[model samples]
Target: FNQNRDQITEQLFRLFDLLSITLSLLLSMWLYSTQFSQQYFIAGTLAMLCYLLISSATNIYHLQPGRDINHHSGLVIFSSILTFMILLIAASMTKTTADYSRVTITLWFFLMCLFLIAWRVSFRRIRLNWFKDKRNLKRVAIIGANDIGNQIATSIKENVSFGYQFKGFFDDRKESDERTAKNLAGSIIGSFDDVVHSARNKEIDVLYIALPMAAEQRIITLLDKLSDSAIAVHIIPNFFIYNILHARWHNIGSYQALSIYDTPFYGAGSLLKKIEDMIIAAFILLLIIIPMLLIALAIKLTSPGPVIFKQKRYGINGKELIIYKFRSMTTCDDGRAVKQAEKNDPRITPLGAFLRRTSMDELPQFVNVLQGTMSVVGPRPHAVAHNEEYRRQIGGYMLRHLVKPGITGWAQINGFRGETKELQLMKQRIKYDLDYIRNWSLMWDIKIIIQTIFKGFINKNAY
Candidate 1:
């Protein structure tokens, strides 16, 4: 039901945005007493095009219901700033900077920002007030009375602004006995038969069948019963029953299929991740090139081995890649029995200990990033020996390779770095890695990178 509402709201928003941009430009020109010329028309069109592009890319138009008005306004303002920046870039590239009035441009930028913020805040208030009386709310019912069903009920109850009126659960077993019915929550209203009865009577608007995949026959029967009604129905699959790694649904031609094991980096997301890795890696490499060279020299003078230690490690898709680090240990162990670096280990050179402690040894992985073998942010790669050993010990251990290995990762920043002596410690590390893959957003990656700058560099566990 929210889909239809959202579609309508989005269409209205697009029209409002276009009108706001046009009026803001005209107002700006009038305020600056500048004649509206052909140049002004060209500049206005360019600005409007940039605004639409930036807004769509940043999700400014796809405003979700029940968001904080302040946060919504901030996003609008930010999008406006980005649009202005793009317009400026376009002007510079086209060599048309002199054709536009500086005063008019400045006024238009501020005017547009003010109007955009005002429009969203006003729209939010109006929408919230209209839905506050519950007249526009949809009547919803859940079919199952299991854990996932209860969780869904609780979530809907907590988020009242979702405009859903929870009619209650419709489980057949729960309503069979008077004693069991009394112990159940007040939301467990009736049986499966009552669900069909209510839907036919138009008492329910949306029905959620929170049944497990095993109950295929029961689900199909309910589907058949509800098919005649005008009510909207949805199935909440219990994917939490398994070790789901970034599980999602996709349309393969005409058929809808779900992925039990998947990667989030697909389509435009993969390109965006690449761009992010390249830009950040290039900038960081520029900053640390001199220091990396100095560290290389120090390693050569203080150690008996190579300055750059190219060890075989498991990379994306569990492929073998040469992971580069400044050699901090006496031996290059890439064999099946490779030992993790321990506290003050004998194999660690004096300089190597310092490098590991400061995490300077991993700096050369930026080259791995540029080589496209690694990302600036992702699950940190492990040795081939470790991968083989842990793949058997830990569940979903190999899922980390779904994305490219990173120089710094979610686990490393969250105190799961260094030697994992206990199997539980390694399990916890893999949990964080899989979690990263599950919720891999550009903002999350940026947050991890910022956190790494402060806390990830000097971990006590990295001996």
Candidate 2:
């Protein structure tokens, strides 16, 4: 079943690539007919090449077969935009801009985007339908029935498009007596040796070695025994044992290695983030220039201090950065004795209270985003004094600086925004920050950004 499924998935990918190329060619011909220029054909073909290359670089085509299209749509859109911009730049540099009609190019861009989206949606539907048929699914077994294993099982159950038929778990201990196997319900089939025998007999298609990190010897022994079998193996990293923020692999020279503690913004990720920030910041600045001017005037009239408040905060890599915000207090605090504003704090001006509540005060940070000191979405930067304080109290507070700080973040959207008055609150915020890093994706960033637009700006805890 697994071999058949793999073959089908491979065929589907080949079909997808062929369709993409065909569509690109069709669109190019349409543009040529509309504009009637040789240069336009060249430009369109170059654009298609750019899209394919960037899509590959971003792993858009390398997604797990059963993954939902909606879950990855944001990455698709982002990569598409990156591809479009690269093509546009290339066209401009080659002075081929005049060959393509602006209207036709615009239409082609929208059409290609629609084509890509439709293809992914169709693939998702087809995969889901195949899973429902039950004839093409892979039989999967878990090695351990612990929390991590159960979590994997739950995910497999939820994502039916992955076409994994859970064949139950294998543990050394008795089912009822095993604490780790308890929550797994009835998924346990037999002992570890039984799993080996089943694999040898081609009963299990895939085997997940979900053992805890402490069982290194047991894992090694299991691997030795399973070496003769044909089942695919995967290791579920025990990341829960240590706090990780944006952990990922890095390549130094020709050696690729994992980083237990790291930032997500590196290489293509950094470049993509900067491009996103620049685009967003530029649009925001254009749209809100007048509103910002009015707010500046209001702040100048309502308060005696400067309209913009610049405070010291930790940026990416623990670097000192001057974070900008609309002045919201009678007195600014950037020192060691900084105090968080509470409800009806006397230090907050009347306008400051309103700005803080509505998150209007954060608008100026778009400048920070443009200045390369921050991102449009990431772990929010804390005051340098607060950083100094929390680094001692929280286990991984300093790790938030792994990436550039953002105007809004997962913690902010999840109601961990505003003040961290207690040690527990700070710890909770750090936990979310680290989770964001561990599960970093372009789609996740877009989700957080959308959530922030709808509900994060008006949080009751913002004050």
Candidate of highest TM-score: 2
Tens-place lDDT per residue, model 2, 1-463, is 6567766765576467546645755675576577456775566567667766665555565647544465456555665677678877887888877766667666666766677777878867876887897769899999988887888888887788778888888987766674755567336788888978998999988999889878999889889988889988887878654443334667899998778887776789878888888998889899989988999999999889989999888898899999899999999988777788888899999999999999999999999999899899889988777889889887878888888889989898878988667898888888888888777777667667756766678988877
For each candidate in turn, give its C-alpha RMSD to the true structure in angstroms. Answer: 8.0, 6.5
Q: Model 1 clash pairs?
A: none
Model 1: lDDT equals: 0.83
lDDT of 2: 0.79
Name the regions of candidate 2 deviating beyond 4 angstroms: 1-18, 21-37, 65-68, 82-96, 240-291, 294-322, 326-361, 369-378, 383-394, 402-404, 408-463
TM-score of model 1 (CA atoms): 0.63
Candidate 1 wrong stretches, greater than 4 Å:
1-5, 66-78, 175-186, 240-276, 283-368, 371-373, 376-397, 405-463
Kindly list the per-residue Cα lDDT of model 1 for residues 252-282, writing each as its tens digit. 9999877766888999999999999999999
The 10-residue segment with the lowest total lDDT in model 2: 239-248
